[model samples]
Target: MSEVDEYLRFFPYDEPYDNQGEAMDRIHTSLERGQDVLFEGACGTGKTLSALVPALEYARDAGKAVVITTDVHQQMRQFVQEARAITRQEPIRSVVFKGKASMCHIDVGYEECQVLRDNTRELVDARQEEAQLRERERQLLSDAQDGEERAVEARDAVVDELENVAERVQSISSEKNVCEYYKNNLTGNVDEFYEWLFDDVRTPDDVYDFAEARTMCGYELLKEGMEGVDLVVANYHHLLDPMIREQFFRWLGRDPDDVITVFDEAHNVEAAARDHATRTLTEQTLNQALDELEETDDPRTKRAANVLRPYRDALVEVYEDSFGFGERERVGDNWEDVAVANESGRDDLTIEFLQRYEGPGYKSDLEAAVMLGKDLDDQYEEAYKNGETTTRKDCQTLQSAAFVGAWMREGTDEGLHPVVSVRRDQGTDEVYGRAELYTCIPQEVTRELFEEVHATVLMSATLRPFDVTEDVLGLTNPVTMAYGLQFPPENRRTYAVSTPALFSSARDDPQVQEEVGTALHDAVRFTPGNTLVFTPNYAEAERYAQRLRQQGDATVYLDEAGVDANDLRERFTNDDDGVLLTSLWGTLAEGVSFDGDDATTVVVIGVPYPHLDDRAEAVQQAYGKAFDRPGKSDPGWTYAVEIPTVRKTRQALGRVIRSPEDIGVRVLLDERYTQQSRSDMGKYSVRGTFPPEERDEMIDLAPEKLKFAMMNFYQDNGRYDGPPPAP
Candidate 1:
């Protein structure tokens, strides 16, 4: 569309989806004006072309940067595959961006890698040899019925050599060629070999040199011939999180506002931003760090110890105040600042030291400090000198306090974004710390990131109680838009207030359980399709789901019932007539989608309300009077937290009926649908039985309610009639 020509070109599509051409036309205009575009398409509305295809076109024609950001990585993969199919031989420059940890870094030379491998291999061989020698000596003695002192001594000598070799191998330092960024930064030397080892690695084998997730960006940034890169696809973290934005996409240049950013499933913005802003670290982690420091003499090992001592001392001083032994109702609101206020805990001081502590050979000190993980610290010098990949990314890495996730995006007068991460230190086995941060009231991040971006397009199917999201995000003034992306009348049925008092303080009337069971049973009874029941809390989700399951209702429990994300994906993908009962609008309720015949009916039980958290009281007091008036606000509900959650429900309910031909049902159990929270539900709802109208034609009201509704809904609309389907 611009002056740039012949850089790259892909054949125009002969056939495209209903909206692909129109979508690309909008994009062409957007590129012409240098404006950002947010397109919200219903599930089957061909969203990829709106930005994906257009971005590629823009990358070829305008020579402008194009980024496709999606919270869901799987969608990103599908997008990449589609792009590859379209531009099989086109010169359209494209690369997937991922975090630094995702790629493998040849941080060490081949010889070093080989030396470490060979030495370790030798140690293993020597040990095997010694073991065989001892076995042989024993056999010899047994065969002769006589003890051979010389043979036994020889076995012992071999064993000793094996041990010595192991120790020697363990003495040198080596690093795991785990991620390409690390390889690019450390081995690429960033100086002499930038063009050699530092360029991006395009194929899958090299992408593994990145991260477990194989996030989009890492694939592109570390490509073997990364220059002249055209389109860079990434997630919000890569574009919004400064540390990530600077490190991964900086290669593309910093002016993102000027760059075309297409947010796929953009509606995840609020929750995604909130999650990115949350900070967490723990005492167990700090202690382990201290332990790691004592294991090696590598400069990084020593530097970490030096950096931690002052903080340790300061922690001891404030320990009595910030923490107490048992479940002592979480610390105060501003405890984070208070913990670091004592000169020793000053973040700036600790950060300065962490950033500069050079390694033994004057390499990046941060790289060296990473080696001090509790499990592998003792093996640091050995791994470094040898060249082996270590340092954790999964559970072990979770314990790290690297950068400690502090935020100073806003200052004291506006409000301190103070947060104190705490959890039942259920030991290392089940440690879960929850962090709360008001990024809008930044306490640690650079405010320039938010203020300088030219335009940010936040679009998700559901960002509910928009005002509440605005209040928490402090972005009430942004241009807001919504699309009525409803499922087809023949595709889905929705029931409002299907059951009475399913979960609430007043829900314990014994009969309520039987009633819930009966309703849930009917929801799943005849239909072999998957059924998802959303509850209000973990306990309630557990209670109702357990009740239904005890009667062999064939249900999978979602969150609040001790169910997690894995469990959700399982139930969504499992065979036994997949049925899931979970907290309404929980994480799973909001973020996951089940396509095809995987889902049929989603039952929402009660409104999602945040329980009384440590800071809930203060938050309620601050804006509760102004917005939550009369009996409108419940202390049990952090409207700040819950409203966003209900929006999650809206999204979950949207998952099943992805296309017009797909049939599904949404059942809301909360009687509150007749009252106040009803407003929150409607604002973000894609399809449902809107109250006052109460029950839709597809909504079944009683005993025969479910069976009759299912029959009719399928009578005319079920096209997958190609065969029997999940009920």
Candidate 2:
């Protein structure tokens, strides 16, 4: 056997599947060569275990550290469990690190809780020394003949309390202002604490329970122990934030060169980074800042607050005048003209007025206000730590000023857009407003994050059309890997619901809506077991659901706007037979699994294209620049609209069959999927080609064909090669 085969023999799972073995080899090789790898593996390919085994193997052999971060903590915990199982079979060690906020033992802010933790060790040592002296005295007193019984009782009481330190220490610590468990155990036994903590920590709740039992801060213990761990599992935000990254490095006493980072569900990482980079200033934020400033004694902070209040007013005026109340209007692209109109001044006057506050003197005011804001925040937290009831003022005016001032002066990157909108109450017309600076194309951010690690791996199921993802995510010509179905391909099928109907916004009349609704009602009625209907928007979903109800469909569950989504999902999954109507990109589209009879069919309506508003237009223009689209084609629209639509549709389809034994069918309810030409409209306007010659997974929308194909596919369980099966 070869060296690679030898390594495979040690894989701690129930033997890697065919596709899994290939993925493992590719991941190991890429990490060895220090090349970033973008891997697309389907759901049942064991992507997590595949990535973990090879990455851990590489780390073990190379004496390097590995950090596995995902978009969700549940996934992180799942990974940690898998890593632990692997370690049981190997000689590697792993650690799971949730952020400070998550692992905090107290109901206090991170900064304040950290302060309490910092001094805990010293306090515990001093308390322990005192307790030892008391113990000696108690023993001596117990030896005396006079009052011997009372002395024994006193000594026993002291011993009992000391023994119960881990259990009742939290209350003791609160009463005496000392962490009793820290004094008794964690002060000198960091490794022992981890052993106890991880002994039964299968989830976040388990971590909290274990720590609470010992009255120890899980964050501190886990953080201190991360240095000796071979693999660390955490959420993506922990590594994406620069401060958190630096803090982790300091804890490890190592640099970026010694680590390999694997971003699971990496398709979502760029979007997370983009969100991290975005900032918003809400009217509530401004009001809170003003309230805090008015209560403060500092004249400079008060002066800054005075200017900030008007700035807030100016922003509100802009939103109200430009977009009107209760309407979502896009902000204009011309910053100077918008600013002039909102401030009710000429361009030069507006620039001068805003710049005056951003100048040297106002800079001092801004800094002072920010410093005071921190002081007040810390004060409130300290009071909370001391068991005093304190109300925190939501004031940070200078911070808002700083963000707005910077954006106004420096403008935004080519890809990012600044937006403003106003929301008003129906009865009172009380205005709540927001201003946001955001970016849809996250390639620049993704590129920068990749540069921080020695080697990186981006993995997802729907990262197909690998070249597009590579270009869109700004990878450095990395090796692209794809893994096909590990399950019976015959168990799954896709069909186009071809009807001469218009579902686009251009034909959003009640007649078209009713026709679309009727088609969906019919599809749900025909399909047995559990069925999921994906519409372009909530309004449409509600319409279709109403139509279903009118047609005597009692088992219709509509995803209402602003409802608790988890409850909705639970209700849908718990029902053995029903139809669930949800919008595309809603909670049901992704990050959910409805295997077996839970979801036997998925029906998707028209493409869920985003509105071509100002922010989206800005992103499109940015994409044009990023791809350097000097040709006739619009790269922006393709990247922002077409790509996302396909990806979301694919995500919806993916939910149908989650396991090897699962069977399901996918129905596309739009004419575009059935047309010979790529048609955005009914007239058949092909972009470049119809369905792209390479993708052979599409089939006709005939009902009989769909039924026959799905039934036969499941019955035969035939293996799928490269071509589509005959209907």
User: Evaluated with lDDT, which candidate comes out highest?
Assistant: 2
- Give per-residue CA lDDT, model 1, range 262-321, as digits (tens): 666655664466456655555555666676556445455665555444433434344434
User: What is the per-residue lDDT of model 2 for residues 522-584, given as tens digits with 9 covering 90 to 100?
Assistant: 556445567898988887788777878888653888898668877887888888668888988
Whose TM-score is greatest here? 2
Model 1 scores what on Cα lDDT? 0.51
Instruction: Give the backbone clash total of model 2.
Output: 1
RMSD of each: 14.7, 7.9
Residue pairs with backbone overlap in model 2: 289-395
Poorest 10 consecutive residues by lDDT, candidate 2: 336-345
What is the Cα-based lDDT of residue 165 in candidate 1?
Answer: 54
Whole-model Cα lDDT per candidate?
0.51, 0.66
